[model samples]
Each structure stands twice: as C-alpha cells, then as structure tokens.
Target: MSEPTTGPAGAAFDDFVAARSTALWRSAFLLTGDRHKAEDLLQAALVKTWRRWDRIGHGSSRSHETAEAYVRRALATTYTDWWRRRWRGELPTGELPERAGDVDEAARAEVRHDVLTALAALPRGQRAVLVLRYFDDLTEQQTADALGVSVGTVKSQASRAMTALRSSPALTDRFGDAA
Candidate 1:
C-alpha cells in the first residue's frame, strides 16, 4: 500500500481512513460481493478522496463527514463505471468449494453466498441503491446524493431491488417463506 501523504491534509485523510475504514469496507464488500473487489473499490474511493482532501475543507468540524460523503459518492460512481465497462471473459463453475470445518462458519458462509447471489442478480443501479440505503444505512436522500440520482429514483430502485431479492431463488431456497 502507498504511504500516507505528509502534512495537514495527509493527517486528516489518514485519520479519516483509520477511523472509518471498517465501515467503508463493509459498504464496498456489499457493493462488490467479493473481498478483493471490495478492497480495490475502497482503495480507489479513498484515493479519489485523498486527492481532494484540502479542497474538501480538512480543518472544518464537518470535514470527516464531508470526506465520507465524497468517498461514498466515489465508490458508487466508480462501481457503476466499472460495471458498464466490465469484461465478461471469466465464467463461474457449478462446482462448490470445500466446506469449512466449523458448522457455524459453514452456515454463515451459506447465508453470505445466498445473499451475494441474490445481490448479483440485481441491476447495477438497484444494487447500488440497496447497498447504500440499507447496508450502509444511508437515508434515501443521502443515497441519491451518493449515486448522483434523485431521491425518487433511489426509492424506486430500492423497492424494485427488494422485490426482486424477495423472489430470488437463491434467497428463497435458503430462507423459504422468510425470503
């Protein structure tokens, strides 16, 4: 990983990342549904935010909040752009990987797999809205802002995404009526 930038802007940026990286990583993971992709997404977003740290008013009381919003926006836009230009050369196989020894871990992995499968089926916009509004716990307006969409668009996308997920075979098979 690259070293943190020096001086005031660097200090602020470093502090923001240190304090919020875990939560940000969760958002990224939910958005990408893959650990390596999530790490790349978060790193890309953080780099974008770092480039504008001074302009984002690093010394202000609300600097961290501003930086958070900027980073989230970056994450959403970058993911969408990547989706648009995605290379589909790689294909998934039907074979399942070996299970973990721990029963609890295996159950958690199953749930995660089901959820990721369901999420992967969503349209890019709907997936982004769902991740931002639900997983990241952002309000509809905040999600809209992050996505550069209107609040109504966020609401509709979220609703449609939820409806699709509720009907998804991956989730339905796992959770039955609850899904």
Candidate 2:
C-alpha cells in the first residue's frame, strides 16, 4: 500500500502513537531486555505501521486492537530478525540500581531485575513466547498469531520457557528463599 500521507491517515497514526507508545515500549523492553534497543524496536514498528496505516484497518470499530496487533507483529518479527542477524552483541553491564524510593519499591525493582535477567538467558524464541503469552496475556492462538507460529509451537515454546525459568538459579534464589 502507499504510505500514509500527511493528512487524515497521518493524523490518526499520530494520535495512535501518542496514546499507545508507552505500553508498546514496555512490551518491546520485555522482548529485548534493554531500554535503548526497546526504543529502537518500537520506533521501527511505528514507522512500519505508519506506512501501512490506511490498510491496517484504521478507525474501524476495533481499530485499537487491529492496530496493536499489526504493530506488535512487526515488533516480534523484527526482534527475531535482529536475532538472526546478530545485530546486538554487548552484554548488559549489571543489574540496574534500585531507585531511591520506598522499601517496597526497592524490593519490587530487585525482583524485576532478577526476572528480566533470568529471561535474558533463554533462547530468543522462548523469551518471545513467554513475553507474548504471559506478559501480554494473549491466548495461545493469539500468541501463535502474533509470533507467526502455530499453536503447537506456542505451546512447546511456553513449556520449554517455563522449564528453563524454573531451573534458573538466579530466579530461584531471588524468590526461592522468600517463601
């Protein structure tokens, strides 16, 4: 389709981006496990979505859902493509410092760090599967659709992901002794 021009379609795309970019960024961050990469991933998805705005079921009764599905698919596929290309190479420096907030906030940040670190160890497909299935709360079919895989693939990926997470020493140590 032709690119969305600087008119009604462009305006609609702008409004959608303004309203949904933050949530999309969170999802991208979960998929990528990095702030800078997540920003780039979301930006690339937005650009692709803008290019296809007119044909993306814009302003339909379920416009929000349709647009999100399109952009999310772009995010997932592009992330996988990047993995195949080995675009990112550097390892994370360390767990981020907890923000100077309440005690509870500090604990939550630590837990989040542990979880994300553990997630980063899994293979790219398994990580994507878990993020889509559990984090995004998508159904098996929906997750499969988003990742461009079959339902069986989704199930297997989720099963393997959970097994890997269960065996992660860092994750177990973080919450294992708490209970």
Screening candidate 2 with a backbone cut-off below 3 angstroms (N, C-alpha, C), the clashing residue pairs are none
lDDT of 1 by residue, 1-179 (tens): 34447987788787888999999999999999887899999999988887777678677769888899999999999998887899968755443354668787778877888898899889989999999999889998999999999999998999999999999999999889789
* Candidate 1 lDDT score at position 43: 96
How does each model score on lDDT?
0.87, 0.87
In order of listing, the candidates' clash counts read 0, 0
lDDT of 2 by residue, 1-179 (tens): 69978887788888889888998898899999889999999999998898888888666648878898888889999999988998467764766676666788888888888898889999999998898889888899988999999999999999999988888887888667431
Taking all chains together, the TM-score of candidate 2 against the true structure is 0.91
- For model 2, where is the 10-residue window of minimal lDDT? 87-96
Report the C-alpha displacement of residue 47, candidate 1, in angstroms. Answer: 1.0
RMSD of 2: 2.0
